[model samples]
Target: MAGEITETGELYSPYVGLVYMFNLIVGTGALTMPKAFATAGWLVSLVLLVFLGFMSFVTTTFVMEAMAAANAQLRWKRMETHKEEDDDDDDSSTASDSDILTPDSYERAEKQPILSVQRRTSPNLFEITDRVEMGQMASMFFNKVGVNLFYFCIIIYLYGDLAIYASAVPFSLMQVTCSTTDNDSCGVETDAKYNDTDLCWGPLRRVDAYHIYLAIFTLLLGPFTFFDVQKTKYLQILTSLMRWIAFAIMIVLALVRIGKGHGEGHPPLADPSGLRNLLGVCVYSFMCQHSLPSLVTPVSSKRYLTRLVFLDYVLILAFYGLLSFTAIFCFRGDSLMDMYTLNFARCDVVGLAAVRLFLGLFPVFTISTNFPIIAVTLRNNWKTLFHREGGTYPWVVDRVVFPTITLVPPVLVAFCTHDLESLVGITGAYAGTGIQFVIPAFLVYHCRKDTQVTFGYGTVNKHRSPFHHTFWVGFVLLWAFSCFFFVTANIVLSETKL
Candidate 1:
């Protein structure tokens, strides 16, 4: 029983776990969704958003089940090792077969139900206690090629995340700081459209300002890659507060505008052409599956875990609907900015200068808080990918090379294009598909098989997904493939048209 348990981290109530999950899923993607919603039309966006949210929920359950199974496997291995040590110490002629059942023996025992496992305490073999990251799960459930592919997909996704953050922070600053007018306050109602070439500060153009801010951003936050980022409780609370205030302000402002009949938006009922990007945005918006193990495993009690997660998804879906629907109604689809907050900065939409400034700089505040953590994550993942067992890296290579590789590519990508919409879309569509859909499907499928072989079919995983049937796993995989093909075809056709 002692060998069967492993410490994860500071445990919390399921409600706190739900809040953490909600925060993780609703990040930069939510900010980009309003524009995508406007482009795709309300009806299509609504239908697809609901469907994608459900699918995300399904896969989330898959990850939870897999986590439980992984814990069972780890616990069983540790128990076996402990039993082996005991056997060596005693060298008993009558070793208890029930205590150390191997896979083959477990199969035989399944046929012979008369046998019973004796223990001081009969603990649930499949209870989820340890936090197994998606990377660890990948290694456990996937073949060598699949493991490498998982890392590759995750690395690419993180790179996209960093690039989006990089471009977004500077882009937000550029929008707020650059002006066609001579006034320092920069008339929010100015009719003149400024581009990269437009002068911001005398000799400095808007593009130059963006680059300057990007460099400043790198200098300010990029060094955390060389160190570690341990986000404390206060930091989490502060960021969560900023996020809620920003979201509440945006939603309220949009509603107020529409309520007053000052709304300029009239989105189409259906736009098949925009569905491509909408799918990506929705997928990206509901992405919490990759980090589920870290979030879910720390829950002190999981008696109502399924219910809690379902409730979280329901709240999230409603929140997303409110945010996007109001945006599409209050702002013209053609005029919707990539980052939805930028739309609020317009004096026409939001009259208050303070609110406009806060909204404009909101991405800067939130994204800066996340940049270091993500950069360090990417750096560690790089080190992990190339890492060999029993081998040690030199200080320069371990400290300098990994961080440099992690920090540079994303910044370079940001320099090339600051298209937040496309970055989120491509990242979510391709890599997010792998993480959110394909990986969970396979992980659950493989873990279930392994659990049956190792723990016998009679052992019940208390944390098993509601969608425990094999059919559900197959369905998820099929949905993933269909989305991938459809998105690829759409991208190709769109490119050809261009």
Candidate 2:
């Protein structure tokens, strides 16, 4: 009763901890990282991956530490309240303001500590709610009112840019397979009478505008489904598993592509401009903020959080570094969107067909996994607006909202633009900059406090440090500027078509 309980009601803290860690790493990023590598050369992308993992660890540790301190403060206050209650019991004649206070007022007094701690420690609703709120803001900005529209615009831009790259995985497979397999006539250049344009099998393509719109819609829908937390657990679990499976598939594709020597015609590392462009894209895509809430859970211990973060970063870096190097070494083209598996399939290499199948299935799995996130977001917002509890609403909304939100826009966007690379670039430039970089810095800075100690020189000794103030101030300025410059540069460059 005092601690965590297993299925048979047995206390097992370690099991609980492991479960939390599992949930933390399973998400959209796991599915998308492989695709992102297609844009930036594998080497550069790997470096960014390592960097993001490190940043994630540091930020998560800080967040956990702050949460722990807040919890301690709450416990101390509760103990004081209990002591006061005991004192009141001893003094029978003392009937205080509580006797005159209404039930609502009394309840408000009881909730004061909780509210204070929440205000002091939580930077955004996402931290408190265990959901991503920025996605909602982006969704609204882009699809709804378009007011203070810069953020939404940027997000749409980045989404489009990244989608272009993502779409190429399927396209590459089609092109490579068709071009290499049928050798009926070597060096045949004539337009044959049997050339059936209708039978021309190509990669699945989507329009840029449609991709951006779909990304925004899905982004909106993901966080909303968390409103009905109890009913959505199954959906969350399924999506998480799919994400991991997709990762596994991606890993297989990467290995096979590397073994086949695919990067025969890739751009040279000596070309600094291309390298820079690749680096910029990698940084933009990898530094995503959506995963932060998962990383910093209230239940995680500060020490464990810090250690795990470090471990996660190291693993991420190693994986990405290996992946990127192998990819670039194997891919043989200057195209930004090199689907490694597709390129390998062109050689008719062993296991290439299976790799292509996995790569093709990977995107569908991503779409499925992404749906839950979108649903959770939309559900949460609806709850906020209507002030309804989980049981109060229809189960259909809880079950269907995520899938609907996720599937709808992509279906619509399928008609607009199929360029995945441009979609991804635009999304990185626009939404990625703000959601990943700016908001967290603002929350840390705005909620920072100064430490104070009271001391009596002769009878008492107390010392205080304004550590929080200095830390937050410096961190805020540093990250804020970085976010601003990154977003600004993205917008400017994108607008000018640089």
Candidate 1 wrongly placed segments (more than 4 Å):
1-6, 93-123, 181-194
For residues 394-419, could you state the per-residue lDDT of candidate 2 as single tens digits? 66754575335434453344335444
For each candidate, what TM-score against the reference? 0.92, 0.58
Backbone collision tally, model 1: 0
Task: Quantify all predictions' global Cα lDDT against the true fold.
Answer: 0.84, 0.41
Q: Per-residue lDDT for 385 in model 2? A: 40
Residue 63's lDDT in candidate 1: 92
lDDT of 2 at 483: 47
